[model samples]
Target chain A: DAGITQSPRYKITETGRQVTLMCHQTWSHSYMFWYRQDLGHGLRLIYYSAAADITDKGEVPDGYVVSRSKTENFPLTLESATRSQTSVYFCARRTDYGYTFGSGTRLTVV
Target chain B: GIQVEQSPPDLILQEGANSTLRCNFSDSVNNLQWFHQNPWGQLINLFYIPSGTKQNGRLSATTVATERYSLLYISSSQTTDSGVYFCAAQTGANNLFFGTGTRLTVIP
Candidate 1:
């Protein structure tokens, strides 16, 4: 489709294991963002990329790594998953008007 | 960094009822947007109102940038309207910040 999509909508991983969530947007938006949503705390930005190869950390970036090798794709990786990292991860793209968010990936680490 | 606060952290309404959600920001903003996260966890864009007011069907939103706040009104609510409504703002620095959101549950 021509919209944003996230893979592995639901995932379960053991603590200390490596995991990656995929995001793809056909709109070719210049700005891509990754956010994690948990109870009590709202959505916190983990990382954002202005364009391919240009990335910056947001409010919460620790324990998360993001790369945008292509304008259409931005993936977030967890080097060593932890129970605290278990949450619903969302991918979004910023346009002139506002943002378009993916369906989200629910990650559970035990 | 700007701070965004949303009022009525949780709300319950009967179908066909009307409700209003409010969002307050700590600083001036250049972009203001309202989003509806459906029950399925899909974030859908509702309105991009930086200033003034706009109405779309049974939903309407108003942003008073100078006053540093905004309001979202939903009339004749439907069961499908149950979800979290988030209000986000882009400050002069060009970074977007979202509020905790208002969780609305509509009962039929």
Candidate 2:
């Protein structure tokens, strides 16, 4: 796809293990975001990067880490995955107007 | 942080029916966007209406920034439209505050 993509559309990992969700965009957008979708809370921001090497925390940033080494790649990593961290994760690129979202990655920690 | 609230948390309708979804924010926003998440969990951007109104195909959206609210209208609903509709508001910051979402089910 030419827009945005997330790797490992579905993932299952053991608790206390580390998992990294990969996100890549072809547009070279200045901003990229990581979000988790839950039952009642809708989508909550996990982290966002304004540009390469410029990142910031979102509403729910605990237990998660994000790094943007390149403008096209923003990967979210869970240092120690927990059952509580099991949720669908989405990556988005902010366009001039709105955002271009990628297909979500469903993560399950057992 | 902005508090985004969506109305009619759930809605059910028959094919060819019309529907309206509303989103209200607590503070000023840099942008207001409406998205449709299909059964398979793909977030498709429907509208990016920060103010005034915009229409595309069978859908239309209006955002009154002064009023701090936005409305989404879906006309002639179809079974394919059975999905969750979400309204997200973003301030100048990078993060976007999303509403609880409105679950819509269109029956054939």
Candidate 3:
């Protein structure tokens, strides 16, 4: 209840469908990030929000979208899911100590 | 962009054994941290050592900023320690670059 959390621990979607992954933190951290983990790629940032209404792209942000209307929530959306987008997604919040990550969401596209 | 590489892609250790994991960065790092991805896919932050050394229980980490490398030491390994260890680096940016990770298996 005190840390960040992700919704839909596992998901199966059809190609070309739209899907949204929700991330929420209780700390209201100023920075929140979205990353995807693929084999051999480790974890690459997709998008990040410095604060409410300020979102920026990271290394790989194509085909995905993010919004942070409030400090506690940063949701990532895949407009057209593809097989290549199938990977574990993670959400993180920047803390004074370090970045705090949420329980990842394992997504599959068929 | 900074590249973070980890050594010993995979490792297997007996319970009560010890192992060391290494992380190398391509550029000077402003921040360095280590994390453990558990079997349930939770990323648990273990250390945030940009320089010097820090210890917590059986886990300890040392970062030599001058060398651009860091090492994680785990003594008396346990079954619960079986997971993937990842080191991430930041080069004066808000984005953190992660290594491929070292998968460790501690068999009982």
Candidate 4:
């Protein structure tokens, strides 16, 4: 129960509704990242936080919002969900050696 | 930003066969990692070989940073090894850039 975990593993929302995916890691890793995996595009980074209150945009940050108020939590929110945002979202925490990813959240926008 | 490319985009192997997956990067990298995403969509860390070689069970990986490439070998593959393998790199950045990945299907 001490590893990274993502809530709402499976979600379905309307196109214009607001949705948020929660990611929590107990390791207290300094780096937390959010990535969206889409067909043919691989895993594209949406945002990353170096430390508490320090966040940066990644390759594909548009249509997505992220915040890191606590070192152990990095949540990604979609202000207005779209059909294109329907994909498996993954949250990862980076230690000195490597990264550990969550089981992933499968979000479907109708 | 560094570009990471993985070879043998798709592969099929028998349970007792051996296979190798390659990853090439466009620039020098300070960190390199190989991950196995199982059928259940869990990304498990296989190896964090920035340079040199390391092995675990039937899996092994080598990262030749000087050449900007890495190779992952799986021997006596099992049906459980059927999934996508991803190679990610960090070029002095805090975040890792992942490749398209190599999908390996092991038939028993």
Instruction: Indicate which candidate wins on DockQ.
Output: 3
After superposition, the stretches of candidate 1 with alpha carbons farther than 4 Å from their true spots are: none
Go through the candidates in order and give each one's DockQ.
Answer: 0.74, 0.89, 0.91, 0.83
lDDT of 1 at B19: 99
Which run of 10 residues does model 3 chain B get worst, by summed lDDT? B89-98
Model 2 clash pairs? none
True contacts kept of 2: 0.93
lDDT of 1: 0.92
Give residue A87's error in model 4 in angstroms. Answer: 0.8
Q: Among all windows of ten consecutive residues in candidate 2 chain A, which has the lowest summed lDDT? A: A1-10
TM-score (chain A only) for the predictions, listed in order = 0.97, 0.97, 0.97, 0.96
TM-score of each: 0.96, 0.97, 0.97, 0.97
Which of candidates 1 and 2 reaches a greater lDDT? Answer: 2
Q: How do the residues B4-98 of candidate 1 rate in per-residue lDDT, one tens digit apiece?
A: 99999999999999999999999888889999998888889999998999999999999988899999999999999999999988876536788
Of the pair 1 and 3, which is ahead by lDDT? 3
User: Candidates 3 and 4: which is better by DockQ?
Assistant: 3
Query: Which stretches of model 3 miss by more than 4 angstroms?
Result: none
Report the C-alpha lDDT of model 4 over A1-110, residue by residue, as the tens digit.
32899998999999999999999999688999999999999888899999999999999999989889999999999999999999999999888778879999999999
Whole-model Cα lDDT per candidate?
Answer: 0.92, 0.94, 0.95, 0.93
**TM-score of candidate 4 to 2 decimals:** 0.97
Model 3: CAPRI class: high
